[model samples]
Target chain A: MKYLLYCIFFSWGFSLFSQNKEVLYGLDETPQALLLNPGARISNSFHIGIPLISHLHFNGGSSGVSAYDIFQKSSVDINTRIINTISELDDRDFFTTTQQLEILNFGWKNKKEFYFSGGLYQEFDFVFYFPKDLAVLAWEGNANYIGKKFDLGEINTRGDLLMVYHLGATKRWNKKLTIGARAKIYSSLLSFSSTDNSGTFETRISESGNNIYEHLISNINLSLNTSGIASLNDLEGGSATNKILSRAFFSGNIGVGVDLGATYEINEKWTASASFIDLGAIFHTKDVESYAINGEYTLDGIELLFPPIGSGNSAPPYYDDLIDEIEESFSLDSIYNSYSQMRPLKAYASLKYNFGRPVGGDEGCDCLNTGENQKYNQSVGVQFFNMFRPKGPQFAATLFYYRKISDYLTFKTTYTADSYSYNNIGLGLVANIKILNFYIVANNLQWYSNFAKAKSVSLQMGLNIIIDENK
Target chain B: MKKNLYLLFLFTFIAFLFSACVKDTDFNQTDDIALTTVLELDFIFFNINSQNFTDLGINNTIVSDTTDLDFLDSEIVSENIIRADFYFRNTNSFPVSFLAQYQFLNDNNEIKYEVIVPVQAGNNIDPVITEFTEIIENNALVNFTMATKVVVNTIATSSLNNINGNLDLQSKATYYLRIEE
Candidate 1:
């Protein structure tokens, strides 16, 4: 039997993520709703968030295999379960995570139909596609993978931490249409990715006269690009959330973006709305470090030779020469290059049927068609969510019911289907007690019944002071 | 007083949500890639003219030209690959068996892997040139982190004019990478 061997020394752990706030779309009464749709329905004259308590949100989910798929106790071997899980996942499957904290938020309405708002918030987004080829190689080894071309293009992911400073204006053009636009300055603190890689890892018999087979690494250009961690701690560099918060504002890398949204009344009972948010990009130039390995090599065996340090040559440092030769073949280059990344753009659209605003026990604004306020206490609607991702565009369809329980409490429930889960149920509660207001939104409610099996989960909560004047 | 109570409740709810978040466990896996290219070591070791000389009272002795090796210096020089099967390719025109030895050295001129293997002659039936690898049981030269060079020495049994056996080294390097979140 031919004895083939190779030597490789080191690697580092890195990751990426992405985002979408589905539940908050089209829920206009809460101040946070303006983030999703700047032209969302509003009945208040002024509003402000309670310092750090204004808004806090985090979302994470995997579209492919859940923890229960491999970890749940089963009669089958754990290795077999893991293999099955890997088999079930493909390149299209991805993991997405997002975290956001609103530092400041405030809005005020004009004497007329014009309203203005502005806010500063920190956001972190990460997403990475499952490298199925790598998984197959890991579980089965190259012996069975002979002749199969495991593609390296499947290794695409992106992660970023940034601060978004935004200001927006909403104007009621007429009795039926309200439009809004938001301008934002994005200051990126951290960015990391190894996207658009190209290569093929394959194994086959030696082309020439030899008993050994060759594992060919052809046309590989795997790059790891990162920025914004110069002053971070050595041991707890990327993990300390407090460190990230400390560097949230005024990161050297900055870019500009815009959000546009509009709400229109199709008729007396039918209302439709659409919004396109995060249409921007951030340029990373400060503290940038880019690493690249772009080349090819072939290996049949590794027999490294070294000077005998002592008697009998018990250990010869092993494969130092082979490692050197492979390094020659597949060179790694480190450079400081500036790059720009477009925001993870998302689109939202909704169509709702209003049963007319319920006459509340308290005296308040009741202008139903002015396009500046809502007179409906109950409504049913469907919202379509689409987020631009590295692999492709992911979509979700949501059907929701909303009810106003007096003037102090309103509840909304939604059923959704997306790439992550088919039975995603969401709940949102908005409490408006005079000037004091609080809201909480949670998606994938059914998963709470079995957290271990959940493919996705999201939560958002906020507190604000609002003033709704009845004319 | 009602507003104060509402604020208290909101603060409590926020506290509860934060507490509930705790820590989430995420799992991920990744594998590295390596290319195994087989180089006919004969190309580097077979640059010799047929030798015809008597040495130490022995007639018709054969010797091969020395082929110098210089491993390149790049950051891809890591020691993380698993060893597997390897073989030697033989296309030489020898009619009889012989002895072949290979000596590899590091930058500081230290002999790391030394092995003497038998070579089978080419024939109409049997395989030629038995494979020669650094058959040291101790994995001494497996994790070498420095630059290296290789030299091959051989001897023929028959007093022939064209005594030659080519050397081919099949190279295979594996990369292992891990991704954690």
Candidate 2:
């Protein structure tokens, strides 16, 4: 847990370090090279670029669960021997449940072009499970013991995980177009449980010849149970020694995806680019478990020797077999098998334009005509992406503002928002100098009429080293 | 361009602040009304010699001449007359009614009898005795006498259980009182 937490925090911090000009101020609308900014790639050579990135996503929605009456009316024959030998207990009632989920995503990215950009993401979720109580009554083999009762059990389990990894490359076809592709692998783990035990019993007796002889008795027992499956115990325990085995089974699969991007220098101050990234499927291994309970009775001396004659003191021949049947019948492998069939896939596209003079140049723009010109540059962009397969299309526009406060100090601010329907907002800041690049970024700040709640905020600080190829 | 981006940033920041400050006045309001259905009962003890007995003018009045029966004292050789009675009412101002019954039995035994109680709708402020049966005597302890006492209050009615089979009873009987709408 601690290591996973560290990885998540580190990834978020790294994302802040690799802030793109478009993502910072909501100005860039097109995808650049996988690691380097669109403008930076034009200035730098084929020098390998490894950029660490992070993302925070959130989702909230309303859902409901329904219930059905699982009471099956059955005509059970009352055999004296069967009733006496195996106490006649009531059949267990059945109940169904439905639940809803509110989700949040926090992610980190480490990209090494031509190698891989593995990511660790934490998906926080809140699931609500509601079970309706069913009316049930059990027979205790006596006339005076008939009572009414219902189950009162509810399932409330929260917190889950969605982790992923990606590997791809960015290849420049020419100065006008850049193409890149990324393959992403991801998985989700969800689980929850609850149990309830409640009911009533009654007994009656008759008076005869100066003595109160026992007449009848009835016992009704009600029990409720619920539960959720989380990650294997290895992941639950934060021991470094158990990392190997835990990671082995915890790791799901690897999928392939490609990113194709092209940058057209439309003019001296305007550039446009577009890219399609991460189009693939990942599968998880199968694991399953189940739980259940049962009740029965034995013959009382009075019933064995009295009116219910011929009832002997021997265990019912089929009692064990019946319990075994129940155990095998409730196994959860079928449910898990169905869930394993679903896959995770995502795709996105962006368009952006930069309006500024090239660094250390005089012919680009009048704003940079002087060496001491301290005025800042500005850019704007928009992006559209599909999250969780084809669930919904997300649209966002960003504004980028940069100012040189001093020779060694610079300030930057970004504001971006998705479609008005979902209303997701993001803000970021960066302090860049010769020795270090420290920055902070926050995403999903408010709820749109279409969205549920705030997603996540990422803060990061790291050293920025610029290495000259000649050195 | 820088100034334009700054203006846009200012506009978005103000918009976000405005949205964040927007209060949700529409809310689902729920009154703290507990809708109860289950009425659990506990055992009722009738002390023969206790002076706390009061004639509420509801049940039969015990005249001064009537004999006092004490089943607890071994020296008193009187018939153990255990009578269990349930009172029903439609507490709601509107005529709320239900079909009620009393179930009596011994441990691991057959049910003795089912006594049904019919309730009328909108008949508030009335206590109707659903059961008034007397337990015959065999000198054996009545299961109710040895069990625990429990009082339950439901939305429709209130119930009292005199016999709790949780513990070993020297002479206790089990009785179930259930009401359904």
Candidate 3:
């Protein structure tokens, strides 16, 4: 039975490889190559084929203050006010900044057939922020010891990982007309941390007949902390961490989509292709967890009360003494937490053209030498193949232009009013060595838009390997 | 085709497992308490006929050396008593319960005589008169009489004393009344 299952899997994979023969490399327009080029497959004779591609594409400018950030800022201000009142301070300052490291695509593609291919890709990011610097001061009174200062430091961390499966195929009617399509399956894992700390000091002044006669002071430090790791598996299995972090639930949904592309021979020497890609959504089983933590302290003569911290089934009482002291002196009340989720859709498209022809010469190459080639090689005096064919090997020079129609195409949550056009203008040189069944590509890219004043440039080079048993 | 079926089965299993294990708990609801305001009063008083109270036809009458003085028949005497009653009622709300305590004060700015009745459930209860007493001293002829009628209940012609004070009457007096139900 196990062998039978293995044979079936092998046959399925074998058929996919036999389908993608013609294309040297799957196009870069779609993150899900297999989904876009479902017909793409390894050539008939080759047992295996591999293509390593690197993409350095950036879309969307810096996100403005997220609704979460706005809420966090307001919460911080509120917490600060409560802290100040409890400490009897005239002024206080607090600061926070959130950072997210997003990875959109990272994976390897395998050809299963002459016109078909499939693979998996990963996309995710680690998001965290250290909201520190809660500085407070007690006003100076008649007693020299009437004022003191302290800081409350807190850090928050959260992240998630997404894996998507893609199936694609490529079809070539002849040497000049080629088309492709692909479909994707998406899934993800998520987790986060909830922890905070606070410190406090007491300032006291002796009053004689409505006047301050002397001053006394004391200091108390308290820390409230809670930490746990949670995952989709754990969440589903009723893990303790899941309960502690119920706020962090991660689930994924399957969405169906198709990528369409067509490459045409403009002439014997030049070819052009346009593709609509990455146009799909991941129906989420549930929203991702966004969390936050807020803490405060108060001072009364000789005692302090650190804020209370609660998680799942555990509530710490180490700060109880401090909290009681402060409450009796100067009351404190405050709350803090961070929450947010990402939109599930994204869309993209590109148009490109190659300006060179096949390098090796053959009798059938005469087609390239026809009058149709004159338009691409003016130096050849309309002789076609003589001017278009490469002397050493077939190489192509290419240029492309691409843009995002709407950021909101994927999920409405991704839309922004500052939305503007993103354009990429680049040059690429491709060398095809038919005998070795491989190609080398070098490219220089630049991306810019109305959103930013400066343009970002990157240099990329990679090799494409194709194995064809028929050759 | 079997591979596709297996893939579908795998996904369904994962979904079922996830759905069954995940738990969502709701927060408890809390309610806020509301407060109401109430009114309170301190004192209420009314005094009439400081002297010769029997001038008004009553059981208590003083016979002088010459004849029985028909003080009640004298226009000036009756007019004086009427003026006092009018002064008390006009100076404040009738049933005195209708007015708040702060409304009364003489030119001297002293609250010598005052009545306080709380306004409960949109209605005011009149002040209760708790004591009434009269005494005469010296050779001066004097009499004491009083009449009280409150909400259909009447106590009239109540007399305390009648005598001659050789000099001006010097006596300490007191009166009392209470609201009926």
Give the best candidate by DockQ. 1
Candidates sorted by lDDT, best first: 1, 2, 3
How accurately is candidate 2 docked according to DockQ? 0.03
Q: Sorted by TM-score, highest first, which candidate order results?
A: 1, 2, 3
> lDDT per residue, candidate 2, A361-455, as tens digits?
44454433112111124444555444231122333455445443322333444455432223334554433233233333344444322111222
Q: Summarize candidate 1's per-residue lDDT along B77-161 as a digit string, tens digits.
A: 3233323232344344456656656566666667665556676766534435454433222254363333255555556676555
Q: Candidate 2 chain B, which ten residues in sequence have the lowest lDDT sum?
A: B162-171
Between prediction 2 and prediction 3, the one with superior lDDT is: 2
True contacts kept of 2: 0.00
- Report the Cα lDDT for candidate 1: 0.65
What is the per-residue lDDT of model 2 for residues B66-164, given as tens digits with 9 covering 90 to 100? 111122222211122223333322222223333434333333333343334443433224433222333433333344333221111111232112211
Give all candidate RMSDs, comma-separated.
8.0, 18.8, 30.0
Q: In angstroms, what RMSD does candidate 1 have relative to the true structure?
A: 8.0
Question: What is the lDDT for A373 in model 2?
Answer: 18
For model 1, residues A97-170, the per-residue Cα lDDT tens digits are 78888999999998876779999998888887888998677556565567788998789999888899999988
Report fnat in order of the candidates.
0.01, 0.00, 0.00
**Order of models, best DockQ first:** 1, 2, 3
Native-to-model Cα distance after best TM-score fit, residue B11 in candidate 3, in Å? 46
